[model samples]
Target: MNDQSEQERWNARYADDSYLFGTSPNAFLASQRHLLASGQRALAVADGEGRNGVWLAEQRLHVTAVDFSPAALAKARRLAESRGVEVSFVQADLATWEWKESSFDVVAAIFIQFADPPLREAIFQGIRRTLAPGGLLLLQGYRPEQIQYGTGGPPHAENMYTAAMLREAFRGFEMVSLVEHDSVIQEGAGHHGVSALVDLVARKRA
Candidate 1:
């Protein structure tokens, strides 16, 4: 699907009363919170329903939450308010969004699956360009092997991620941590139970 169609689909998915991915930060991100630089600007891409973004804002980082779904952004705003934190919500297609170069201290991308290889590259390059020197990129997504688990994630194995793919995606950056492992994720109904995934923490070179 094109960006517009994808946005519509997500918007509809989030229009319901149920929280699609729950109202908490992803387990992997929460685990690595200490590695995040304090008091720095951060961007959460495809931050549907604002769980992760709100969590980051609570940690005192200036946060910009970007997602294509207005419904999701609305819920994200509500979440930030309830958490007594502030976050900027931007509605735009990441594929065509005008990202400012070297603008963020951290970029958080969790479970934003991009099956299109070229778009994935563009998104990764955008993440690299949008980070300040020595900035961090925290990424987590299901591995292709996740198909067997059927706990969550995109149906197409091609949309899944691998360590090698992430290594190439941030080829020039310093990889602080990279691993493919199994973990029991609990993030509401959409994402829960045991799953195989890839997690990476790469820093932009100074």
Candidate 2:
């Protein structure tokens, strides 16, 4: 889809008053509290409704949340305000967003499975280029098995993640950790049920 169509599709998904993905941070992200510290510069990619970005701000990280949907960004702003946290909300298409180099200390990419193979590759490259030396990349996504489960994420199996895919995508990263598993997750109406998931935590070399 074109940029406008993509934005329209997501805006429609987020048009409702309620958050599609709920207000809490992703489970994998929240579990990595040990890696977070005050004053770190963080980027929350495709941070719809600000849940992850706001949580990062609450952790005292300077956060910049980027999404393509204006509707979602509006809700995110309200969420951040209500939570008494500050997050820089930017509405930009990730496919074209300037992924500044060596800018962020931590990059959180949770459940961003909208991209097809080509766009996914761009995003993977963007994440690598944007991270500062020794930076942390915390990402989680549904695996191909999720298609059978009929849970969250795109129906296209190509959009799903695998350990091998992630390892190759972030090839030069330190590969802090990577795992695949099945779990029942309830993250609002968007993601709920026994799901196939993969989690990756990689760090840039200093």
**Overall lDDT per candidate, in order of appearance:** 0.89, 0.95
lDDT of 2 by residue, 127-156 (tens): 999999999999999999999999788899
What is candidate 2's local distance difference test score?
0.95
Name the candidate that leads on TM-score.
Answer: 2
Q: What is the lDDT for 104 in model 1?
A: 97
Clashes of 1: 0
Colliding residue pairs in candidate 2:
none
> Model 2: what TM-score?
0.98
- Which parts of model 2 have CA positions greater than 4 angstroms off? none
